[model samples]
Target: MRGAHPRVVLGLHRSRYERRPLTAALDLGVRAIDTAFNYHGFTAHQRLAKVAGDLLPRLTLSTKVGYFPGPDGAPQHSLAPSRLLAALEQTNQALGRPPNLVFLHNPEVSLHAPADAAREALSQACEALADASRRGWCESWGIASWDPTPLPDLIDDTTPAPCVLMVRSGLLAGIGTLDAADELTARWRPSAVWGMSPFGGNAEDPVWKTVDPRMFLQEPTAEVSRIQAAFRVAYDLPSVRTVAVGTDNPAHLQEVLQALDRDTDTAMLLKYRKLLRERHAAINGSEARP
Candidate 1:
């Protein structure tokens, strides 16, 4: 398995939640820990190993690179050969082992781009990764895409092809990861699927902290408060199977796991959807009817 997934591994560089969740996953015997090269703080994975020594053996350990915004949070993606080499060396120090898999985090170019941007970027990244792999920096390389529109374009480009997808499948834009999954269903398959961000693309995660009074007006109170319920509702759609959670504490982790266990039936989802829609319509009517 690859590490550095948005959902599970989490970019622990600066977040307080990194330590506890990483510890929980390790204590549970999870071997893979995803991190990003851009993540600050010295040797994040090494720190994890020091804390959870016994769990290291099972860790598949993955790290990513290509962007970082100065403290302001600006982003960048650079796959230049020398830059990758430097990042590889830093990764080795952090994990104390060669990474199992590496991905180009939200590449600047796309094989699926209407223009040649992604195509060119894909080509350059593939070549750079190949050379890095031979030198023992990584064992494999893949791509992650949240957009469904580009899958076709990526397939058409041949050289340095994408082998995996770190997809954000069903969380947004309906239940279609068509951009990442469909084309790959044929010639290749994904190595890992790191999930992230809770509320569609809006990233409104408070839906998890507590049953905010605001959401109560949108649906049944009981359903609104169930985080595990929301997770199942989110994960149940066939579009999403692999998920990653970035809870900063165990109390939340417990909620997430609990929800994962509660089976979200299609009937329930349909009912919930209906409830939300009816609530919305009622609200709109009351406001519009004068």
Candidate 2:
């Protein structure tokens, strides 16, 4: 049996909704799972309940709400307080209990309004989730954003802070997005920060073959593959407390756990961040001059 590894969360974004993997995760002491309302064709929660309702109590469950089934049957994003609250109610029913944490999924997607209106819309949506938490709908609430650039500007005294703020992390994460995530973290001051999509949604991307991520480790080892190295370094790219990763293979989950034991080269990471900033600055400078 493996010891508990809380820092690694099993994300179900690309999961196959299999009971074996959920059981495998618990056996490996990976007790956290992240999912969203619209995943698996809006049936993820129901599927999970049917497949592994018994195992859920042993896991720290987190989910997101904001996307709903549209009139056309496709999922549509919204920040309406009533819609959000209704989804939270459905989430509790579908999972057979409240989630440990619930995030307002991708509010930026619907923030096409002017700055003031956008701020109001976001504040109301957050309040709905906050109220749900207080009412025992969930232990806590959070914000999970794929693009956090617009969020920092809209936050103010009236905006409720989330218990957790989840953003994309890893070698594939852009410098701009990383900087924005850091800024949002500072502004919101969440109790915890989480990183998602460390491989940018696909570990098999050709880009992984070109860059050797082991260089970011304090002491590179032949035992750690490039994928493991990349996953390990994601923790520091934007400085997150925990990361949400997805894999159905028990062997792959074990590989991720092994990467957690290796130390990251903070100095090397700082230098890389600096290089990225300089490159971004140069590109903007050239564009401004033209």
Candidate 3:
């Protein structure tokens, strides 16, 4: 089941856990927070968990397991179900509360291994997460991956189906070619689909980095700010149930809200979607269809 909160989720991964930004976002009514166990030396999740303190019940807390802080404070990926279950225990012990949703972070690693081994590993992990949910460690379990192509294989349905799929979806970084063509319709769909990186992942683009968002709405021509164009595309997708934006700057968060609050121009969104589809198809050498 999806939570009753704003469709925009405040991602805590890049927020550095600064009290001011989180408090300000919460004040602005951002009730859903996304974080991971290895983010910022495993401190980001705890910091946000601490800051929310008494208000935890009112907020939706989603986190991921499978990556842990290594000896040098870098990430060490481990998707073993036993390790994941232990991680959840540690997470609860640290936060003194249960997370609403827990995800298997980047289980795509399993696909790189031998086929038989990969299937077993992924299946075991999913089963373990479902067990954790039964024990009240988390309400539901899902898989978060950069490669959505393997989602069908990972979710064999022998285990409990995932409630969400947190993946990349935006303009410029158009959802994968198959997704652009809407070919994954028959796969196991999630109850809540979350999209990240609305700015096309091009940090150096002048339009995304420096252009005023208002310019996109004000311009009479076909030009649109990269951020606005990206956000609009994400908003228009029927599969994406919510969008996650990460920033340490409270002011920027408010600005993002302003962009989201404006009415989405369906005609404009459709136009851009068509252009993006063709562009992506050209790059992939696939026929672009409406």
- Against the reference, the lDDT scores of all candidates come to 0.53, 0.92, 0.69
- Could you tell me every candidate's TM-score relative to the true structure? 0.65, 0.96, 0.81
User: What's the CA error at residue 135 for candidate 1, in Å?
Assistant: 3.7
Ranking according to lDDT, highest score first: 2, 3, 1
Which digits, one per residue and each the tens of the lDDT, describe model 3 over residues 88-175?
9988886778999998898875567776677778878888998999999999988776666655554455645568877766544454
The backbone clash count of each candidate, in order, is: 14, 0, 0
Model 2 misplacement above 4 A: 286-290
lDDT for each residue of candidate 2 in 17-83, tens digit (9 for 90 to 100) = 9999999999998999999999999999999999999988899999999999999999999999999
> For candidate 2, what is the lDDT?
0.92
What lDDT does candidate 3 reach at residue 88? Answer: 92
RMSD to true structure for each model, in Å: 7.7, 2.2, 4.3
Candidates ranked, most accurate by TM-score first: 2, 3, 1
Which residue segments of model 3 deviate by more than 4 Å?
Answer: 1-5, 71-73, 153-155, 175-186, 201-204, 207-229, 261-290
